[model samples]
Target: MRVLLCTFIQIVMWCGYSIVLFLSHHDHNFYETILMLMFGYFNFLVAQRLNINKSVALNMTISLTLIYVTGKMIIG
Candidate 1:
């Protein structure tokens, strides 16, 4: 049951990320999108390796992304 719940949450996160990515497609270049995807995948792998909860890891990733975006906007 816990595994199923985690999987569901991860799926939701992925879907949300995909929609956001799609919406902002014009804002990012292909290389930037690829790099973001790579970073997300790497973050998931590290979280799994560390035995961290999927939801927590995904939340952290979202937080980090928001932080990055916020910083970029502020700096610009």
Candidate 2:
């Protein structure tokens, strides 16, 4: 049940990222870099606390992507 919840959250985050990425397709590396950093650090922190490597990695990836998309929008 916990795994299912985590998976569901990942799926939602993924869908959100896809939509943002698609809409901000023209954004360059600056946005991407910021996003990656944000995700890496955020995920690292969360994972460290929860002791869940996979979720941490997954969340960071999704978080970075969503952040990048959002950054692109702000700067677009």
Candidate 3:
């Protein structure tokens, strides 16, 4: 289904973002910010397409935080 596909894509994106964030050294750098923003924006689009936009911010934040912590631990 579309939802499943979207969710899978989001997870892949999150992992990719985390990997880049780990490699970037400066987590708060412009590149990382852009990556996060893009992920968030793309996530929002997916939610909007699914008519579930309201929870996008919360979901994105939670996922971002969790992935970030995981990435830190993984690549530390």
Tens digit of lDDT per residue, candidate 3, span 1-76? Answer: 6556666767777788767766887566676768778777776676566765567545754675567657776977
Instruction: Using TM-score, give the best candidate's number.
Output: 1
Model 3 residue pairs with clashes: none
Residue 18 miss distance in model 1 (angstroms): 22
Error of 1 at 40 (Å): 1.9
Maximum-lDDT candidate: 3
Off by over 4 Å in 2: 36-76
User: Between 2 and 3, whose lDDT is larger?
Assistant: 3
Candidate 1 structure quality by residue, lDDT tens digits, 1-76: 5444544555565556657766776774776667667766765665565666877767766665666557656965
Model 2 Cα lDDT, one tens digit per residue, 1-76: 4444544454465456557667887999799567646545554454444545775556655665576568667977
True-structure lDDT of candidate 3: 0.68
- What is the model-wide C-alpha lDDT for candidate 1? 0.62
Question: Is 1 or 3 the stronger prediction by TM-score?
Answer: 1
Worst 10 residues of 1 by lDDT: 2-11
How many pairs collide in each candidate, listed in order?
A: 0, 0, 0
Global local distance difference test of model 2 = 0.58
